[model samples]
Target: MRLLIVEDEADLASALRTGLSHAGYAVDTAATGAEALAKFGVHAYDLVVLDLNLPDGDGLLLCRRIRSVSGVRILMLTARASLADRVRGLDHGADDYLVKPFALAELLARLRALLRRDGDTGEPVLRAGGLELDPASGEVSRGGVPITLTRKEFGVLRYLMSRPGRLIPAEELLEHVWDEFANPFTETVRVTVGTLRRKVSSPGGTPPIETVIGRGYRLVDR
Candidate 1:
């Protein structure tokens, strides 16, 4: 999944971007609320790590603006720890809140919790046909055999698995699986899907993924 970290602290933003990237998320950062909104307008993010104290605008207002536009998950990460602050943040549209000086592990757990609520099921392990994916463990397997995939491949499979048998356009995949740095017109999705197909296919077995000419790709529910 992709995330937007809106933090004015250079050190914190850098740390968050690095840490979240290592945790298998496409991450981007904005040091001000204006920059965050600009980036948000240009990219599709699964979640937002918003700080309440932005240089250009209040994070609560920004959160409201984002909430007004989309239902994307929001997690307010800030130094505000009072009960009123928490309630106000949630009232402003944050799905979750994490105080500063928090543990990355805890933040990840919270983020996963938010994503789980938005996903197809709350089982933690996603299953479709013979494929099994554990988002928490970052593991994918087929028919009891473990399958390793690149970050992009894993993200693509995760998305496809979420809505099995539904056609997904390349633009949708690029928007969600890749960060803002990806070129929208590039053939990256097709190439990544090609490589992913080879890795997940069983010996002498038909591939689980299906492609439609002039359309998009689908993960057969099978």
Candidate 2:
């Protein structure tokens, strides 16, 4: 596995490079955020170990920028142990966080966890026909235009997009979106879908989210 270590401290960076290399990963170290981004642009990395205190900018900013162009998993490392800092890092797009003065074993374990998560999971982006749903940004678009959708609307759309051309019952959608707390017989699913269709489909046209009478819905091929 190829990994990028974005850290400013030369000694710490070298130690990580040596440790990860010995652990059977191809390691690349960058001393600054700029260098990290430049390396990322050229070479695809399996995971990124980003230090929060960088010489150029905050690691959270770098994480967001990387997520904008690539879905690479990020593990944040920093001395800030406050709950707020950790929550902020995660909210910004970090998959995991490790506080400074951490053991090498824990770091390797976290790195392995990130890699395993990435490999086992299929593509996060849901694309059916011309419609696309990005779970990270909760953004949907058809062709190229942005399609604004509420949280529930995006959840319904994402679930449908996950299984294209398959009839998904309202029960399944409710369970998937609302964690089985929603009553499928209610008109909640239909109403949300109606709003979603209006936002995603072109005006005066058939929506991509097709309703199957007495069965469920399907995202049919155009």
Candidate 3:
């Protein structure tokens, strides 16, 4: 899943980004509300880890603004542990609330819970042909054989599976699977897709991924 961390503390933001990235999420960081909004405009994130104490504005206002535009899950983080603060944050449109100085494991657990709720719409496990991918567990299997994939490969496959049989351009995959820091001119998408194709393909069987001439890639359902 893709996530945006909106925190003013440089160390905290960096730590979250690094930790989440390692945990198989595409993550971006924004230190201010304006920056967060700008990134939100450009990317579709599955969740937002927002700090209620932003430097430029109230996190509640930002949360409202984000809620106005999308149904993306919001997990509000703050130093305030009062019931009133938590209630206020949820009333402002946060899906979940997390107090500051919490353990990373707890934060991950909260994120998984929110994502599970989101996936209650019967999309928790994405499937095409003999391939099966569980976003919540970060597990992929083809023909009952488990396959290991890099984070980017998993992101690409998940995005493709989300819109099965639809042709997705390389640019679109790059935009969604990679963050703003990726080099736009790089052929990373092609490379990643190639590797993913090899890894997910079952022995002596047709690959589920299709490449169209001059178009992008598509996930075919057998």
How far out, in Å, is residue 122 in model 1? 5.1
Best-performing candidate as measured by TM-score: 1
lDDT of 3 by residue, 1-222 (tens): 678999999999999998888777789999999999999998878889999899999999999999998999999989989999999999999999999899988998898778778752136687875789987678999867899998899889988887788899998888767877889898899999999999988778898999986799999987
Enumerate residue pairs that collide in model 2.
none
lDDT of 1 by residue, 112-205 (tens): 9999888733468989857999988889999899998988898899888888889999888888888878888889999999999889888998
Give the clashing pairs for model 1.
none
**Candidate 3 residue 123 C-alpha distance from true site, Å:** 4.6
Reference-based lDDT, residue 187, model 2: 95
Report every candidate's CA lDDT.
0.89, 0.78, 0.88
lDDT of 2 at 151: 64
Candidate 2: deviation at residue 189, Å? Answer: 53
Count backbone clashes in candidate 2: 0
Candidate 3 lDDT for residue 78 = 94
lDDT of 2 by residue, 86-190 (tens): 999999888999999999988887876676585421366667857876654457788889987766776677667767788988766664455213455689988
Mark the regions of model 3 whose C-alpha exceeds 4 Å error after superposition.
116-123
- lDDT, candidate 3, equals 0.88
